[model samples]
Target: MPTPDTRRALFARGTWPEASRIAAVLRLETVGGALLLVATALALVWANLPGGTYEEVRELHLGPAALGLDLSLEHWAADGLLAIFFFIAGLELKREFVAGDLRDPRAAALPIAAAVGGMAVPALIYVAVVSASPSAPAGAATGWAIPTATDIAFALGVLAVVGSHLPSALRTFLLTLAVVDDLLAITVIAVFYTSDLAPVPLLLALVPLALFTLAVQRRVRTWWVLLPLALLTWGLVHASGIHATVAGVLLGLVVPVVRSQAAGGPDAGPGLAEHFEHRWRPLSAGFAVPVFALLSAGVVIGGAAGLADALSDPVALGVIAGLVVGKPVGILATTFVLAKLTRAELDPSLRWVDVAGVAVLAGMGFTVSLLIGSLAFGQGTPAAEHVTLGVLLGSTAAALLAGVLLLHRNKVYRAIEAEELVDEDEDGIPDVYQR
Candidate 1:
């Protein structure tokens, strides 16, 4: 290991603990992504059936109306179940910024810049396409945020499937980039999307949020103490009309990432955030997101004509263009500019082509894309349906394109691996490590 005076290289493998944690998170996300796909497929089939049964089920209302809790099943899926997804996102974000590779400003710079560019270019491209298209919906501009998100689970799942030989650094880069992207998406939702916001409920939401924060900070792990406060906070935020998912992020932000002194000091061991992430990630990934997908992805395609019409719609076209073209362009351009400005270089073992492949993979926007689409165009509107199709098509195109590129690169890495193995057989150490 290098002396304390020597700085570790950017995108180095990181600590063993960090690597292990990343691997675990990727495994969870990979499985979650598979479930998300299955749910989407099921929803599509249910939606296209002759009876309109899926729509009726989605429209069915439940819960207590006294607290504005009674809502269509679709609304609950969007507003409530997704809070769990966002909560996990929040936990991951805080952990990264606080104790992960992102705590180093030098390491954080590239991914932060790339995430901003990824979001900006997509939004701009969407606006441009919508503005230029005559057949765009009246409020299509609102959906500019649709392609700004990178679904961590879907992208990670695709990578896990295709990139066995890929370098660990590339995976780290993608994870950091996507986490930052999620932060931006959450900001857009809270600031640009909120309407009819109620100050009383919004202010009142702080009470439970604070209590929950305190509980986590004190290392209170009991489910009974924490779960009710979390639910109440979510409910009040929903009442305030600031998307309930925002509450999840807020709650996540407040959870302490470092261990308290009584627990053996800051670096003694994993803190509550990690513990909470471990507990809730399964619920979010396995049940919450797939259920949301079941409820939201059920857009009835009226055969070939309907498919043609959706693809023709300017809104849909914009979303597809944004994901397939704008995302990679933005990420690559930003990374290039940042490297030039800082006079920094990628890790010695990696190449610009490797970065290129990950940039393209960043285009796979799914979960938050669909969420923003629904919020932009009212749920169940024709525009919303078009948005769903665009997201589906755009994400699929990105996945296919990225897969081809990464698979080619994977073969190159595999050859490198073979060479290293040969060297190891001769000297009991890989040539690169021997260097």
Candidate 2:
């Protein structure tokens, strides 16, 4: 261990910046997760209350009407604020692809496969359920992708709380899987959800995107220059009928992950990508996401009968089944099959049960699911409301189930940790033998 002064100097020089950055992200996400829960709860209560205040607030529109941007408060939150969250996600994705575990094919294979399985299974299940149900709406098929996403912040937050004693590898696996899940979700939003695509604005978006990429490539870290470019690109993308959040992801991808000579030499510090992530992650997690949740999660549960009706709706039932059942079944089944095929065992510290618990945790599809639900059925419509109810109910169930399972897993991990410590003290004698 270093002396206090040495530690201070190292910190000042950013010697352990990666560890610091990771810790900062984890802390912010945990708090954000808690805030998200609060916002969702508040929305639920406010919407369910006697007053119609929630709908009024959510429907309040403010923006330039001339540019066709006079969107409601809910749209602004979903489309505008969520871009920031996606930007941070894009940065994380780029970092992972460039320098993190995802850079290696061997390390990436399992999570990528699991993510694919996780997405595909839920979608298939949703489509099958919706199609089989005669009561399903005409366009219920579009909502099939709603439950395909895994909320990274919420999932990690739950893991942090319930699996504090679990191996770091488990968290790593979850993060990787979530990242891939987000990528697929983004792609689906871009390809399937876009309507009335204006080619001109879409092409115009390339200009700002290119300039942004060039600036970052040249080590230009000026906020004024980059922010305008990002906004402009987002505007163009928004106008082009694709989801505007995709612009954030593209902007993030363009940023160079590796440091250049202009960025204070090879050993100078973290790259621009890392710097941007550190600066924006707090904004994304603490503000953008929570605000989005407050806006989007407010659904009028009507009453017990209303909730029952929503749950009984085929679309709602499909989302619930997709997230709570299909998600885990797909993820766990894929992992097990891959392990068997490759003859690759899990890490010694982990078990199949732990993976199952995590798979269940992955089913907490809140943010992206809500977004997709809105895109599938017009926001504030009865169908959309039912989708929201399904998402809330499904995600809540997943969280509670995962919490119980992972909490027990955490206890087991703690006991194993104690056994290892005891073994170390007993000259390598096994804990069972010593006992």
Candidate 3:
């Protein structure tokens, strides 16, 4: 063991620096998101203004292009810009599954459990609450799932509000849980939520994604090679009528996680996860999410659904209850069950109380939830508007409440040890590529 001074030096570069990095990242995200919230408020005000143009605010496609590529660039923000935001979601998902907290099963268990409970319970509640035709008659059953997601950005932003005292462990927990939440949301889109099935573009995407996977297996690391291939996949997948954002997830899977174990291998260094994150992370967080928030978060009220309608509507209520009530209970309950039965160790640095608090915060499902809304509600009805409002309201509440609760704790680096996850090499098996 090192002496206190030696440990202090370690803390100097790794612990303190890590904490600072987390703080800075969280601050930027929160501030940007708050600005997004403000812009959304302005949009609402503008739409409801006496001579203002809510109809004029409708989405417009870019008929003119700089090159041959078609882009959506009218008034609505969701049409063109949100793709990069989801692309970042894909990248982060890839990283966690690689050499991050999600690398080991024990490390991932709590978040997975919480995520599942958060998803399932909220969905059930949403269905129960919205089993009517007030907003959508035939689509009522499936609409409950609308509010069952957690927004990773908003959750991260909320955690930022608590400042640096927010434990890295908590951050890890939230990130991993959000990945599982996205996975569930994706499944819902592919399965229960789709309108019509189209196979041509999906097949085209599948072919390239398969080839890309083969490239990884052979240890191909050409950024030029992988980059165009991903764009091709994105184009085909979009044309195929599946959610285009999923193309990013499929492409992300083909990207390698950690440095190859062998130095002689083609992918011998910091792997695609780190490479992409280092280069593209800024663009995603800085530009994509902000743009998405600016476009998608705006809602006008004049009983085309008022705030009261969102609060009182069955679809909205189900979403509100599902995210707020279902998420924490599922996380805490399942975590307790699994840990006790298997005798897996809890993080020694944190108390069960801390775990409880973190679970509460995991309900902030803004970004992913919004994306899911676009998928589920975008083409359909008035409840889509109501659902969007409910998502904002629920995510905001979860974030603020969880941040305050998490602040009550002092220690965060819970010393968790697991048995089944042993490896001869120190780095542990990468979870980044699993999905």
Q: What TM-score does structure 3 among the candidates reach?
A: 0.78
Q: For residues 37-108, could you state the per-residue lDDT of candidate 1 as single tens digits?
A: 999999999999998899999999999999899999999999999998899889889999999868988888
Weakest ten-residue segment in model 2 by summed lDDT: 426-435
- Order the candidate numbers by lDDT, best to worst: 2, 1, 3
RMSD of 2: 5.5
TM-score of each: 0.90, 0.90, 0.78
Q: After superposition, how far is residue 214 of candidate 2 from its true place, in Å?
A: 0.7
Compute the lDDT of residue 182 as modeled in candidate 2: 93
- Whole-model lDDT per candidate: 0.88, 0.89, 0.66
Model 3 spans > 4 angstroms off:
1-39, 50-58, 63-80, 132-138, 210-225, 260-268, 303-305, 410-435
lDDT of 2 by residue, 310-410 (tens): 98899999999999999999999898898889855565556788888999999999999999999999888999999999999999999999999999989
